[model samples]
Target: MKNFKILNNYSIRSKLIIIYLFCVLIPMIVTNSIVYITIKSNEVREQRITMEHAIERVKYNLSSVLDDCVLVSNHLHNDITLNDFITRRYDNLLDYYERYNYLLQNNVINYYYNSQHVYQVTIYTDNDTISNSSNFRKLTSETRQSEWYRQFYNNNEDMTISVYYDDNRKNYGINNTARTISITRKLDNFDKTHENILKIDVDYNVILNDILNEKMEDNLYVCNKSYILFSNKKSNVGTEEFDTIDSIEEKDVKLNDFFRFKVANEAWNIIITANEVSPLSKIVERKEILFGLAIFNLLLPTIIIILVSHSIGYRVTLLGIYLGKVENEEFSTIEYNDGQDEIGKLIRSYNLMVLRIKELIEVVFKRDAEKQRLELAKKQAELKALQSQVNPHFMFNTLESIRMRSLIKGESETAEIIENLSALLRKTINWGEDYITIEDEMLFVENYLQIQKYRFGEKLTFSFYVMGDCKGIRIPKLSILSFVENACVHGIEEVSHNASINVSIFKYDSRLFIEISDTGSGMEEDQLNLIRDKLRNAEIDMLNNSKSTGVLNTYMRLQMYCNNNMQFEIDSKPKEGTDVTIQIFLDEPGVSNSFVKENQNNNF
Candidate 1:
């Protein structure tokens, strides 16, 4: 009946508003996230297509370079110097080259292919044929060599390609600069001597260089079976030794023989590279624009949604606040702005909480009044209870002896700090009253800091401010002390920079405030969130949870005595620092019984 009465007391409109808010909020988040992902997917697809087109271009260009070499061979075979030089001597080919200059010279292929091998018209008629030039005048049998006889002539092949390096003569080596490929053939109606052999070497350097010219901005490089010719982002060519199966400098690069991915008709492995314009960029840009617009479009509704939800959340927060304040006599009523929304209904429910509070107060008052009448009888019982207790004075005496011994051993600071701790504990734990001076808490804290001071040396700095006669005011136990330990462990432990800690206690609005701030290695929003989550779920039995749990466990114990009259707030940022303020009311619930007897004794 009482629970039904409690439910009936709150306005009906609040429940409907809460239902309406959920209807709007859930769908809005899901739809916006979906739209963002869709836009990103399309961008990725477009980038892939761009990458494929680029690969095709590299293959076509390499094919054209190979084709140019074939054209040069066809033009040379029809010339007379090729035949005349083999039959006679080097002098016999002079007029033939003059006559066939048009056929031999291709301005399009000449600029880079301008080396002697590409333009020189030479013919070797037979195995022993030697030119009558000054360089070949004394050519012996050992000096004579035929590239055509070994590679193309004897095989009766239509054509053959060979790469040759004559180390002894230092002559007629294809891509003499790099030791490369050349095309050769045997001519049938040569009329040049008995040898029907014709040898032609394609200048591979010229072809490779042509590719470098066209893509003036790409890493247009060639990697033979042995090494890679490199061009940097600036198009400067150099050589890079190949040690691995391969490594790619830029993404989507083609390494015909280097890559392990299945290839299509893959001779002449080509590598094509680009800088600012890559497949990834195009894909990302296109998708970003599409989905970026989608996400941008979602912002308006999102803002409205946040404002509405926060309003609802704020009302709930205030309701919890009102219930907490009513637990003490400090606040007896909850007044709020009128509205027909769900929050308005909640405020109405809160208004009826006043009646619940009134009934609780009456029950407690009647109970206490009866207890006062029996207080004389309880005093007799308390005397009996005291009679059975161990003497706290004896424990303090032992601790005092330890303090004196440390002092005698020349540990003056250690002795002084321990002496203070002994007194703080004796007064707080065994005191007859629940309230103690703020000044007394400060003394305990200062003594604790003094012990830490000797350990940290120069790394720690502290400040303390006390107000409202820090004496005779009861408080939640283990409130400020735990945070001090937390500050030292988390804040100062990892800091490389100079560190300082400031602990200030004061009074505002008839409340006691203890703000402990640390300057050390600060934390980012994400780190701070993770720390808070660990702190909030900690129960009193947190020692069993994990060894790392700290301030949160102490907070659970404090909440038992002070309830929500104590407020804990944390503010932190990356590389900045952390501030934890624990605020408590000086008087609340049962002020006399709330404080541990230890703090009260320390007050005097």
Candidate 2:
């Protein structure tokens, strides 16, 4: 309930801001989160499907190559010339070479030409007559102990394919740098007494490009039962070993590292490893666009809410201000469109109430107006009487100064002091004006200070530093002189030693500054603070009760005259001195003029 009351205390604008965040922003964030998750899931599924299809295509292509190898092995096994050349013992190397040439031309050449993938064909036998060449070699104990030879010999299958370095290039005096897929098969004669090995090396590049040419964003490998047979990456062709996929129960399934597809007939499996590039690259590329959309979604509603709330709040505030005016008996009607909304209806009702109040008050106001005129005249008379009271006190002080000067100088400086007193009184009684230029006011202050100088003689000293440009600026009449009078009467008179007074007038930026400093008996901190508080609060009753009425009256009058644009400050330290500073902004000349006009209209 407490929280509810707190919420109710919030303005309509605050409520609308909260509503917009919950209703629009929260839902937008939730929807965006859900959409992002859905998109990511779909992308993952599509990537899996794509990987599976690529592996399947690789398996198909590899199977086709294995089938071709089987067909070639079958043709070589049935050929009588190749089988006879391998089984029969020749008498001489020349005769063996002739028979080997015939076998190569008739059968081996035909098989090599028919298959575009075949790199070389070789037949190795126990017969020594068959000389070692690129395509014919004599089988030995060293050849039987080789890795590819042992794999082929131990396998029970008819044909086996394994990746191996082509060592036959050594027989032809060339470096054996080519890696090839070797398809090996052991052939038996009719008596099963003689055996020979038939080997076909398929070009690894041709198999990869021509057979498994379906491009994928992943690495594809064709592995034998124990080791890799061929791979799109050359580094993994023969050096890498298979990860024991031969024992897996499922023929086509996904493994931890790769997607596996097996060809049981050839004991070969296709493994696909996904690359570093994700399949959702398109979505990642639009990251900036997604962020921009999110920001737009958040800001669009907030901007709309601010504009809408401002319209309603602004009119409501206007109504409040107008109501305050009515309560003060100003009787000003609110000026706005009579809209159809609730606030508009309230405004319309307020306008009707103001009209009725104005009409009802007119008759009574007329009678009160006459009575108020008489009362205003009486108040003006009383204000003049009150203002005249200051002059008597000032005149008595001047008379006392004249009397002191006459007794001290034996009437020699009396004439001069009396003339200065006359001039000061004339300036003070010129009450028709409330404002004068800075230059004219300084002249008046000089006259007053001059009379004081005659009374104090060398005991009181004063100086004025008025900037030429600031002399034309107008300020309240007698504002500066009041502070100077206070410095002489309250500050210098209380001290016995010679005291100095400094008055400066200058302009800084758009403001005019007047500083009056006195070296006299300064008040204590507590007394200074009390006066400062009264000046800041600007309480008329406090000013009436205070002994420093001249400073208080001057402060209040300047505040009214400048509409608080003027700044007044007092700085004093006990036994050190006191400084009074006044600053008036010159940006609005009408403020000073309006003060003079209002005071004149009031007959003060």
Candidate 3:
């Protein structure tokens, strides 16, 4: 309930955004994702099923071809003429040829010669009288050593399927050494005097082509335990030595699914494996349609929601902004001509309230301002009257006459003191200018210090130094002089020994630094702290509560002169000395004379 209340506090725009996200965006994304995943899963399953069916087709084609060779072998095994001819010993080559030619014409193997699947048929016997020929050969010691002969002779089965390389065929100038697949059987159907065997070499290319005719996307391997007999890949069928089943699998790492069946009493395998196909390839085909649907489902609804929400929320938000301005005392009317809704009525009511309050403020504010203006004028007249009491022209003329008389009396030191006093009075009494160059201010300070030097005699010493281009930089009039006056009055008056005051001015890092150090009776820690605190938090109101108004007044004036962009520091040790440092940023305005003058008069 609390969460719902907080949600209700949200603006109409926020609520609409939430609706777009959950109702439109999320459902659309989830629907598309489920569709994509279903399509991918089906594609993978179909690929697997297709590969399995292809393997079955390849196995059937392979079995059919081998069955043909098995049939041919069966006929030869049962043939009494083939059995009798090999068993009979031949007396000579001419007589053997006559018998061979006659048998060849009447042989059952002659029928298989024109068959496309059968390559050759040969009979081997141990009869020493029978010469080696194309169709019949006498088994020698080397023939006994051959792989196929040994397997057949040792096997207990009457018939066996074998795939082996016939290196002896290479001598027939058949330079292509294709591996041979043959069905070999012992011809013991009729008891014969000599041991006879019949072998049928099937056309390897014909079986391979049959497998290829299936046009399976996968590689197909037909293999026995000992060797791979044939493959859809023609190159795999023609090795001088048949490759092991393990070797074929190593080359075709993807060949995993296999079917095992007997071929002529020997176990054979048909392996089917597919090439890799990218899963995304099928998904990409439907992406454009899915994208279009998503735009219709999510984007279209989102755009509608935003437009409707903006129509409602925009005025509400604008009214809220105007309300905020009113909270800040900015009584302004709304410029938008909104509808006659509840919020529009509230705006109209607020505008009426603002107009009434503004009218009341104008009436009261003007009356009070007129009263303050009259009071300020009276204060200014009284201040000008007090300032008129001190006739600077008369004082200057008198000082000039005294200095000329001292010069005639040959009192050079007195004349110099009088001249310094006159210059100090002129600079101090001038109220028209609040700013003076560092050179003029330093000159005024020098004149004041000369008078102090005359008064203190040898007990006081002073030095003023200005460095860099700071001499022409402008500053508030008497900004440094007040602090110098305080240093002399409080720092030197109580000291017994010779005291020296030093003032140095310089500019660095675009800031003007004015430092004054005096070797005199410094204040105690408590007094120094009080003076430092007063300088830190100096304000026009402090002049009423503090006795050290001179230094505090100068500090505040300089602060206002520099737009409050200046720092002041005073370090003093009792019975040791005092140092006052002022750092002023040269970038700040220092020409606002009326600001300081008005505040100063108000304090007075």
lDDT of 2 by residue, 1-604 (tens): 2223333344555667776685577757765675566576776677678777776676666557656765676777777777777788889988887887787666554655488656677788887767788777889999888767987877666677655555544344222324556778777744367668888776555555642466655556666556555555444232233334354334333422332323223445666665333334454567775677567666666665565566567668999999999879987777785345567767888989989888878877778888999999999999999988776667757777776777687785776667677777777766767877788889888888888998899999999999987776667899999999999988899998999999999878867789999999998999999889888887779766777698989998888878888888899988778999999776655456754453355343
Each candidate structure's TM-score, on Cα atoms with residue i matched to residue i, is 0.31, 0.38, 0.41
What local lDDT does model 1 show for residue 173? 39
What's the lDDT for residue 558 in model 1? 60
- Residue 547, candidate 2: alpha-carbon lDDT: 70
Per-residue error (Å), model 2, residue 79: 0.4
For candidate 1, give the lDDT.
0.56
Off by over 4 Å in 3: 1-36, 170-177, 233-237, 247-263, 275-277, 287-290, 293-604
Query: How much is the lDDT of residue 55 in candidate 3?
Result: 72
Highest lDDT: give the candidate number. 3
**Which wins on lDDT, candidate 1 or candidate 3?**
3
Clashes of each: 18, 0, 0
Query: Scored by CA lDDT, what does every candidate get?
Result: 0.56, 0.71, 0.75
lDDT (10s digit) by residue, model 1, range 520-561: 777889878876776566565666867665576666656666
For model 3, residues 73-116, the per-residue Cα lDDT tens digits are 77777777777777877789887778778787885568777666
Off by over 4 Å in 2: 1-32, 104-111, 165-177, 189-191, 210-212, 225-229, 232-266, 275-292, 296-604
As for TM-score, the candidate ahead, 1 or 2, is 2
